[model samples]
Target: MTRLSHSKHNSLDEKDYIETLSQKRNTSKSRKVLEVKSAALAAAKQHGLNPWSKDSLILYMCCFTSFLCSCANGYDSSVMTAINIMPFYQTRFTSGVVGSTTGIIFSVYTIGGLTSPWIAGPITDRFGRRRGMLIGAIVICIGSAVISSSNTKGQFISGRFILGFGVSILTCAAPSYIVEVSPPQWRGRMTGLYNCGYFGGSIPAAAITLGTQKIKSDLSWRLPLIFQCVPAFVVICIVWFMPESPRWLLANKHDEEAHAFITRYHGGGDPSHPVVELEWHDFKEGIATDGADKRWYDYSELYKTTSSRWRFLMVVFMSIFGQFSGNGLGYFNTQIYAAVGYSNYKQFVLNLCSSIVSCIGALCGVAVADRLPRRTVLIAGTFASAVFLAINGALSARWASMPSDAKNLSVGQGAVAAYFLFNIVYSFAYTPLQAVYPVECLQTNARAKGMAMYGVIVNVFGFINQFAGPIALKNIQYNYVFIFVGWDCIETIIWYFFAVETMGKTLEELDEVFTSSYPPRAQIRKVVAIKDDGHVDLVKEA
Candidate 1:
């Protein structure tokens, strides 16, 4: 009996000791995290740029020029809608059923988007980010030149395809570069600047087209097509002068350069600084987790774990639904306005005004994206967009049924007004968050590939939206707008339940958010950590 009692006592003692050891181990981890953060704060105070620093503002300015790569995409998509109205363009190209031809021309860029990602992902991963962007810029310039000179439909379409190809690659390189390089606090806002760049280029696309419309030569249409080269050319010259992404530098074995880069740009020129160590540790952790070599055959790694798989799915859905959300209507607003008798110069003027409105909305999104729940902003944007689209569809259908004379009344104009409203809402809500969220969802090694995958998914729906819009206008008329309403309702539900919030996370920290076992519907997430700086770094919280 004494022996049995002694055995029980020994077992209980061992259990308690194990528990005590576990606590110590956990305590050690927490201590290390605090130490690193505290050290980083000290270093930032001594050497690094804070969120509101002037040096940080200069960096943002340089980055915006690089981001002008996306501006090419925005300009190209909308330019055709305006150019299609050119008598010279129509005289040379298809005159009858312009919608079908226009849709094909506009959507061919999506085809380029689809194919180029397979190339861009591997190239960017291998050659480095700066080189990848340079290649894209060169191609964009070449494609723009081609479009400007072409007189045949076949040549015209080829130029567009080439533009899409380069722009697709640019889209891949720019976002990942921006997310990787920018400070955690301003990432969303800077990313939100995509709309500003996009519409900034677009306003000119209309203004130039509208200005040249009175000119009596091919120069009227050709000048705008050639103008596409100017932004891309500017990007080429400016981006080469800027520093490469430090994350890419580190990943590609340029550790010394990476260290210096983070210090000079991110840490304010203190290599031994805590900000350097903190950001450095994140990449080290990412490299450790991404232990597998990034080979072409290793695409399976994207789904090797539950975290990656879910992340991949989230990115894919965001890309696909981004188009089908009826936001594509913004690209075709000139044609949409024409349905209400506001074609020609009036459409161009309105487009410029609305592009400015979208810029304002995008600014609003930038302001809030970092501050608010990502899912909430997305839901609000999508829901508000659906309301406007439904109203437009209803009004357009009623006008279509009335006598031809009635089509010019307030109700017809109301449909046009509704589309204009959708433009404002969609630009503000979807433009900034869409690209920002998907890029945040992906793993480091998989980001380029993930974006490549994004290119594929987004272009597929882009083609459908561009192709179907004009065809539906020709066949089903204004009622076609209803498709977006129903589709958006379904998307809103999926987004509310499934989307991960990624507002404040450093890109490296996001690996943990998607990997956590927490259900999506949980309202109050456990506080992960609050830095000494009090900057919110919540992964799921964002």
Candidate 2:
């Protein structure tokens, strides 16, 4: 293991950096901070370290353990969707999975999610990211066991609550670990891929349920519940061997370990690599020893500064918008298909097909995540989703009223097609960004707590969505779709006005953008670096 050297030149650089920050703090007027080329990206390019390189591959494998957190979450969602459609499950449960009873069953999971953030934030910050993940995985396995063997409504709901609690912990810790460990050059795609793992779990769960729906007994639903633990178990087995976040190590005073991890994984075993040096400087500057993460109870740092508040606002926005967008309908997609006159067999098949389409859409999002501007994707994709949702609602309103024998096959098929299209667009837009954007907006000191806050807001809205979706669908029928249609339009406007571009900048570099008088404008400023003197100038364009 190699250690970073504190030479005189580096000392002078640190002094200059601190003084610059102090000056920025004292000044009331806005000024342009020097924005250099991303040193990590430049270093990787200079060293010719491709994605397939030994070091890069190893880093990706380590990151894969975190991806399982998302997989577990995805499996739970898709499996529940399948279970809701199963006649056996409906028969076994006391309430029979309809109306208000259905709402409670779905909402209990998010209710458990609401309880996790208090402990999740502290655990991830205090015990380290790997520990948080491991604990969550173990809890998920326990929850799965409880749910699979459940004999009554209370037992089933308790199991779901436990599952939600465990998933929340993983959600809080895993993204923070991925963003901190990933090199800036690959950060977008890597973190995007983290959420993309949702489809990895969804595909299997959907497929399994499709096959299991043929079973004549309780095992049809119980078997799917049991399978939910597989990804969590995989995470438990492998997470211990993965490297700790370098940012976390440095913040915790494990400086040598931080350096060695960065060297071996990010710098390709070259301690003196520019990526390592730059990363060390940035992590030191960005992470505070006495920041909110170090304190067990103080959350003030998340809202203390204008930048911090802006970051919090973005986190809140993504959390609410991500859940409220008609994707919540996914959990009850079987109900939606039934409303449009699809048979039970057809509903399960469509559910499976929808999961496959969503998986493909998520992969497409991953491919373009690094290439496209974040703001562009959010606005356009959201609007497109709203359009498709409106079409689905219109079709359902027309065709859902007729008797099953009198239903128009073409109109019913169109409604299903529109619903599928809506999922594809939603997956393409929000799926990749949901995990990536929130973490990118947050500073390292506030990351764990902010993400915990994110978990709270997500579950809060998710609870509403899960609890109300069935009731609304039952009473208002197709009218439930317009609520999301209207909200999604509002979401598009919010993203247009407030969303800051994070493309092509290092996490430390984002500090400048967020702290500026107007972050959206600051994000649009073109930064040009002078190779001769290693100085950079920000040219205002937008």
Candidate 3:
């Protein structure tokens, strides 16, 4: 036996050491990860993750960058809501053309998101999470510049498409980077932080634009759109200093590097310790034994392998639910307000208030995510969101029928209150859940690819709903659209019953759940099951 020296005055006494050692042995034997990498590979791994154990400030900073990326995504998606209130769009296009124009703008961004899963997955696999982030920031900055300079709708839409492309790329890369770098105990909170920043970004998108509501110049909307470059610039400047995913290095056959990262990440300590070595061993063996070029992760394998299949279903369902449950409404909220007899300035204020409340909700959600089981929080939040939508839908329907009397001012106030309530619930529920859900559900091998597919689904539905909003608000009542989507709230029930908790569990533990018997209710109930295979079946009983 080799006697090792450790830092004195440590928490890990003799009993802790022996117990940790036993736990490591059991986990490694079960996980089947014990492998090696070349000398350079080992050195590269050591340089990055070596100084911090558990949670590093750098890890949090990296998460904050991810938060900014998500904020950019949220801000751009909703910035147009304020633009819709502007005379620029209204005077330029007819009522019939307005919906189509907005849809085109919304749809083009989705195209950018669609391209990233295919493009980003390979690069992140080959390069690293930090490089992927750096590239995304550069792309986002250029896109913001183009959008700011656009005089015509064509140029404007083109810039939006480019921005979407960058957002889509980060969607897959950021959370994947966070999960790999985060301690298991704190992963949920760290991941939730991105969503906090996401909605926080919405504040300036709404409030700043609303604050400039009095600005009659074309620069009003452009100012908000261009501000996106500020965060992009900041993220690009700081991201270079952030650590690359140690797991990513090990996956590329850099084990010694991985150990070095582990040492620095946890502070200088015995590298041979079970917990430290186990992560390295697992990363190496998992990549090597995967029996494919780690660079090209096949989506088809996501459904073929039991672990991958489970992740695929979770990502698919969550994405669908994310879009269906009024996320699109948030995108076009100003339009919804305009249709309800509010003036343009008032509509801007309403959107600002909603964003403000949502920002607060996102912060609270971050606090809650790691404390409870991931599924429980998701289930509760989804259910509460459904209830909020139901209330909002019912109020809108009644408001449509009510006569235009001064007495109805109270009802208008109530509608505004309900709308903000919906935003609050949505931020606490779907917003963070969408980010963390994919991270929690997928393992490292197919994680990026799976999230991209999820992003694709979300935008597909998003494009449809965005197109539908202006048309519905222009033709039918806003109430009808809310009612229609209020029904989609049932997906929450499916999620509550089917989605597994992955809060503190390891990837290997999560993998086992999908292999064991438990088909989501939709499959059992004969609802649509979109599978590559013709038939849908439950997992085998354990």
Per-residue accuracy of model 3 over 269-339 as CA lDDT, tens digit each? 55653335434534543444353326475566568766567778888888887777776777778766765
Candidate number that wins on TM-score, 1 or 2: 2
- Provide the lDDT at 56 for model 2: 83
Rank by lDDT (best first): 2, 1, 3
Clashes of 2: 0
Candidate 2 collision pairs: none
Instruction: List model 1 lDDT by residue over 313-386, tens digit each.
Output: 88887887778888777667776777776757888887777677777777777777777878887788788889
| Residue runs of model 3 more than 4 Å from their true location after superposition | 1-55, 92-98, 267-274, 289-297, 482-486, 519-542
TM-score of each: 0.86, 0.91, 0.82
* Predicted model with the maximum lDDT: 2
Off by over 4 Å in 1: 1-58, 95-97, 288-293, 519-542
Candidate 2, residue 528: Cα displacement in angstroms equals 6.1
C-alpha lDDT values of all predictions: 0.72, 0.83, 0.65
List, residue by residue over 333-433, the lDDT tens digit for candidate 2. 88888887788898888888999999889889988887898899999999999999999999988896788678788998999999999999999999999
Each model's total of backbone clashes: 3, 0, 16
- C-alpha positional error of residue 30 in candidate 1 after TM-score superposition, expressed in Å: 14
